[model samples]
Target chain A: MDEFASIHHWTGARQSAEWQQRRGVVLGIGDDTAIVDVGLAEEGVAAPKRMLLAVDTMVETVHFNDATMREEDIGYKALAANVSDIAAMGGVPLHALVSVSVPRAWGPERMRRLYDGLYACAERYGVAVIGGDTTSSPEHLVIAVTVTGTVEAALALRRSSAMPGDAVFVTGAVGMAAAGLHALLAQRVDGAAEAAHPIIVQAHRRPAPSVRAGRLLAAHGLGCHALNDVSDGLASEAWEIAEASGVRVVLHETELPRSGSMAAYASETGMDPLEWMLYGGEDYALLGTIDKTSVIAALELFRKEGIPFFLIGEIEAGDAAVELVRARAAGVSHSGKQEKRVQLAKRGYNHFKR
Target chain B: MDEFASIHHWTGARQSAEWQQRRGVVLGIGDDTAIVDVGLAEEGVAAPKRMLLAVDTMVETVHFNDATMREEDIGYKALAANVSDIAAMGGVPLHALVSVSVPRAWGPERMRRLYDGLYACAERYGVAVIGGDTTSSPEHLVIAVTVTGTVEAALALRRSSAMPGDAVFVTGAVGMAAAGLHALLAQRVDGAAEAAHPIIVQAHRRPAPSVRAGRLLAAHGLGCHALNDVSDGLASEAWEIAEASGVRVVLHETELPRSGSMAAYASETGMDPLEWMLYGGEDYALLGTIDKTSVIAALELFRKEGIPFFLIGEIEAGDAAVELVRARAAGVSHSGKQEKRVQLAKRGYNHFKR
Candidate 1:
């Protein structure tokens, strides 16, 4: 039932020399998005702009329920999640094909409202809703969106490009969406959590993907940068980059960024913000690594562009693994306060396992 | 709950100048597939090849049930349906993204079996299984596949290209799949239908899409041909071509091809084979129109390629509608076995309506 193991099994079974040697496939499965050379340019002309292909599916009870999501928010978040994958590949989304299995209970009005949200997001991102298929499901509603995007040839970000001595960075704050989900779930009990934390609730409902920041990073062409979207929590994503790149990643606990609202909500709910920051997912924030020498310029560029960028850790030359450097309490440490390195497990929203 | 009406309403609501005027969009919604320019060549160079995009979804109980479809067939047909769309557009499929929502009861073994069928189809068509998303569903299993393909810039067939005096044609026999389904369903009652009609049963389980035939028609470039796939049966597809092209179509009852097994099965079950041919759907045969002047050459080409081609009808100048010409029995006819023209309604497998 492990999702990753299942994916590995089928993907391995399907791989063949014919598929691997296909003329224009630059990169295939196991990445944020598949990179394809659409053969846009002529043989001797400039290299063709590569296309990024990605798909994401949202099921009724698995990804959302009526209590946690509105009909419109369900549609919006479904497409947004795929767009976030395009962003993680440092690409600009161009077209989308949405396939939805509607339950009869939704009727036509709710379906229209769902599309309203989809159109709104499409307008915001300048993507064309080209085509899709619609069918009725006997029970649950399912939405699967496939997004096609354009990325500069040779500049598309990948999870396997992080190198040793790279500075790991994150855009914007983490754990806001997780905190929002917690608050929404809490509303069922006290009925006050939603009104008390509107920002986090909205964050959970409609996460703004960091497409512009990702584009800027790709355009800047910083040294061997690796990029991934934090859809499955910071810990899981860091592990993805580490395992893919064959490098060790170290994330400093003190440097992990958190929104003020998330901190407030966490304290009010008597929860540890760090737990949400590391393990809670669906933030849609950008997690990446840049060479140490280019870190200063990258920070300056982010500052100039008014993008929230935080240096959270570093990539070290070692076996593929992710470690969290936590600051221990003074009394607990043998010597005064010391930093404790903890190996982080790959834990997050695993579909089958969950 | 009219599927076409719902599609029309939403597509109209979503249409905007930005989407309609997007740089590379050749065709958008309301077609077998969307055509995109992809900007392959530079300015003043040769025209770039266009890309074809299409998607189809199969939901449990709605599209199939355990009694009718095996897990592998479900996977095969889900992908085959989208590939048929690409064929209808005169394109060669290149890549596919599959998003599957599996119910917990199926387990990993059944899921892998489902993918086995998908990989078989992919390999047969020379398509790469580039990317996809997998998730858990609380109840029904849903499979959505999006396929990307390449077509000649100007030679891609369209439903709106039929003209007066065009000869309407179909590839292979019709109603075999529907007859197969009928036999399979009858097995529950009689317990002998499937065993009695293995050819029709196999046809229903694995309907082969006319990819090569479509490619030949596109390559021939025979006089502005209009093409469509018979996913929704002959009557419905004829209505689509008629409506899209603003022409009247007349299908001859005597010309409608039927397989021997289908005819035998229909007789045994006391079911009208013509009814199945017109309204049962999921045959995956190619239905198209070629200019009368080029019909001879087109037939010759098909003969040389050893592809089954049948001239079933003709296009005429009139308002958008489909008609069927049936010869009456000698004793019943008022004027000694005269031909009677009957208007064909748009009847097929409509998702919402069904």
Candidate 2:
């Protein structure tokens, strides 16, 4: 699939979690400033509220590779990467502080363009640049963006919320960026490729976040069990969810959604496209789980909102490992449907690996 | 003096700006999250507040000299640098995301130590590590930390508040860090210097922040006219206040408090002791201006809180500049009782040149 199309599918995986009113959190993550009601001052009545804070840094080449990515896309992807955490907790994005470490060769013009792209992404997601620190670096350009967000008291979403049997669903498709990367690297193009295929390159560079989806999910009282962004590939993310929630995940191969381009690229690369779908990184999509009974309604809501989604898998009982089921009615290895089994890697991405 | 001392003295130049409340900010820099009040629902308000954001970074040799600095210091510095910005704005700090670019030679132990330091700093500051992206670089280890801080309203301290005739003051001593560096780099007295001057070195390496000072300054109704932290030398900071507030600064040289070791180091280096006093950076003390009438009351309040401060200068109406007056002597370099004109270039530490 093209990059935007890939993004469409990738975005389908995210879901927001339920919120609770906790102490010291006047606001959680859905606004410009997170109001934290501090219980520090008074014994019976009034206590002065205090706050604590932080941000994120995602760089191109250093943090991500743009072997075939677009500048605008890079900008969006960088911002979205940070915002995903805010969305996970239903925080409203506030102001942003940015610092860019750019190579001297890129100079001011390229820097301006990069900022324009960043601004575009921030605007699309409804955020502002309040303050930042900028300096020169030796090599490739780096962008560090910090976002402030707020939520109502105790309404913050955390990774430690998933429970066993919570149905797992993804907002969009998987492995689109990885697929795009493979296609770009292979240099194979045909009449079959759409004009918007290059946009996919942009998608790989600039992934817009689903801030609206996150807000809606948090507000609707949907039974989302947990939340996480898919920056480190689906399988890796699955493991994180499982570990955090202390539940096992059984991902059916039949339910996996892979774009045609990703499939073709995987075929050419002598690797399972499913593996790329499962373990290729940098999609920036959100993955969430909800009760089985609430899935249809949530899906319907997303459809009405023009947000794509899929009920890809279910949360399982027992076992901490992420189990992949490969059921077969034919000789082909389809993405997620499975009644049979196939050999799979026991691990996902590891920093120590060469 | 060691690395810590230099960092401490360097930071002394900055002061917290008077807090002013603007619309749409729910929580800000001192908390776990910067909350922004926004209208998400269509029927909620006129304009929904946007996202909260912040950015901070670590340079190769400047912030951390890998040769002598430990991995933990590097990590702590990276995180602390960002957290300071949040504190400056009186916002609550929240989840922090980090990005690092390191030379291949840096190992897993180093990286783990860096994370350990970051976590320790976070724990001390009450922040959580949400997400980040990492990659390799051919040169220096670069770390960018973005912290999201929330504010109750869109209120922040700015550089534009010093009124003419304000009493300029500083919290904590100045020039010690620079003095420590001069001593350490010059290889002064062996054991005596090592034991006696260790505090200066510590001040340079692991400079503790004035977060409490900043918050106190913001909350107190002391009529603070302008504020900034001393990072660049005190003279440079004074210039910032003068320029931002449309005034000139007249400092009493004798009143510029230099720590004991800092003073000794300067004498040993054969460097003009006064030069180091005015120019050495990384003090981290706050240089703030208060209304003339508020001076005594402010000091009284500080006395109650047991916070130390010194009345160092006075804001005057003129071109933005810093004038130095030597005590009990008559040697004219400029006008009036000013014995010497503290030129911007000649005063304070210049990162690029030094």
Candidate 3:
């Protein structure tokens, strides 16, 4: 039997109604190719626009172990990571093409549930699952999703445009997803039972992208010169921004946001919470730098939505290097009337290193 | 060590200059998302246009076994399958996003060589390698590629538009790739060398998409009703057209083209060459229906380019079913009995059955 039998019927039968709401699609699915009509109206007339494209892949064991993670979670995370890429560019995702290779052991019900999860997340973002290819794999499942979105020419932010004197900010707490993964691996799920301080479990299973915050920054037309999402830890993303912009990114270690669940987990395990915040991946949090003048306005916009926005550092004129330091807080003066701090080297995940 | 280091550098390095030749790409690789400028000149003025999106995944064992297939060939086949989808739509492919997951055991140099093959193919097809995600796989390698293309509204052909009286045709020979694969598996590759026939070891390794052929068909604008690529054999694709168009597809089995390699191999192995012709997969040949009057013109156009196109079937007004029978040759007016033929059941590759 064809292993994709279930996926074909599931996606074909279930998604037809969902696809009707999607505008601008010339041919949605069940063809050699899926077509999307991308013309948008401007001043009562149609104007040509640009499209945003990105794809992400998640493999079994590398991303989620089949034993512990639910099939739906795998589907959700696969689409979420790609959505985060769009969020990093300050754009709205309009369509998605998902290609899956799986073992024959997976049945139709499981595939349907997986699509349910994928469709649920896509529905939340109003993205249409336009088309994809499905086939059998040798051993494990692989989910790769490609997303297309539209961006205003002027509002598109590049990672290389950060200017000196720009204030660095992050939309939400980082390292929580990493801590959740650690907890899952260590079987520490019991200790954080009913913990509301940090939505750690939710963080790893379904991390939300800072799409609205990113859009607000882009629309401000302030110095929204740089933007990126923290997928492979804060340090790795910070390095990306620094190298792309060719500017020095200096961060105050004490100012890095640590979630309550992460702090509690770190204390219980005798691990440093800051390390997780710096090196942990899959946070899906937006990190960017804007001119100092727009900082207050950006904060105001996020505050209205009850989203956490924190100022962590600044961009300085220098070569592409990032420095981490423990800066003294601006408070009471010591008896010696002096301030001292310690600097540490940065550490983050490198795909090249085993 | 990471298996994708060279892919990162290779795609990032070689594509910058190549992307300049590709029109409509605003931003290329090395970013959160790639942006494409899809505005077209309509009536000498710019008008918004539609974008075609498709994805295909090639998995180890399922598509290729590492012991027999070279790494570069694996990469070539992965991207070729996706390009064929775009070609099937009569569109020009603009951008591609590749997501690959490989075992950590694979070294960086091999990955680099694999990317070299991918880029070579992409350059030949005028496709820009935009952004994609790379991660480690739990076991085997999985390559998923997404392609973006643009189609003129009037030039786009659908698989469900075949008229009842339209004649059926196929571009080039079918089942050659399958024959090459069979030779490779049976270790008969050397024996076939003596025959000045087309085993075409390169056919399966680097199957070229019928992009030019499809474009010419669409541009003719001469009653080209339905269009589809012969990826899953002639019978399967013919059935797809029959089902989609709500018409009966009748094919003359005797008219199906079989290359010399296929005929020789079938005789050697005591296998039916006709079976391979009807059920062989991955030929990447174009199959569609056009008005009877335009068939000669279409054949002439292909012949001018030294390409082979054959008419072996026709569409009839009936329920969605396909019938295959031994058809008589032209100019045979015998006084004897004329009904000496057989009808065979349709069979092709199906994913579910073992």
List TM-score per model, in order: 0.95, 0.78, 0.82
Model 2 misplaced stretches (Cα beyond 4 Å) = A1-55, A64-72, A152-157, A185-196, A264-271, A327-338, A342-346, A349-354, B1-55, B79-104, B112-139, B146-157, B186-196, B303-306, B326-343, B346-353
* 1 versus 3: better DockQ goes to: 1
- Candidate 3 local lDDT, A137-251, one digit each (tens): 7778888998876655556666777889999988889988877776666664543532542367678878787778767776845567788888878887787788778998877
iRMS of candidate 3, Å: 15.9
TM-score of chain B of each: 0.94, 0.78, 0.79
**Can you rank all candidates by DockQ, best first?**
1, 2, 3
- A-chain TM-score per prediction? 0.94, 0.76, 0.79
* Candidate 2 per-residue C-alpha lDDT over A1-354 given as tens digits, one digit per residue, 9 for 90 to 100: 322232223222221222113224443332222344333222353322223233445545544543454555556666776676667666666556566666667645555556667767666776654555565566666676666555544455555577776778777678876665555554545322234355444445566566676766666467776766676678877777776667777777878866776666566668677766787766666778787778878888989999867777777776566777775644434565435543344454421131
Lowest-sum lDDT 10-residue window in model 1 chain A: A328-337
Q: lDDT of model 3 at residue A213?
A: 72
Task: Count clashes in each candidate, considering only residues at least 3 apart in sequence or on different chains.
Answer: 1, 156, 6
Question: What DockQ do you compute for every candidate structure?
Answer: 0.67, 0.22, 0.20
Q: Candidates' interface RMSDs, in order?
A: 1.5, 10.6, 15.9
TM accuracy, model 1: 0.95
Looking at model 1, give its docking quality level. medium
Candidate achieving higher DockQ, 2 or 3: 2
Q: Model 1 segments beyond 4 Å from truth?
A: A43-46, A189-194, A329-337, A350-354, B43-46, B189-194, B329-337, B350-354
Better of 1 and 3 by lDDT: 1
- Residue-level lDDT tens digits of model 2 in B1-354: 222232223222221222112324443332222345443323323321222446567777545554334677777767776666555554456546666765677765577677777766766776655445455565667788776544434244445577778888888888776666655555444444446678776666555655666656666466776767676678877876776677888888778877877766666667776666677666667778888988898888878887777899888888877787666565555455536544454244644346
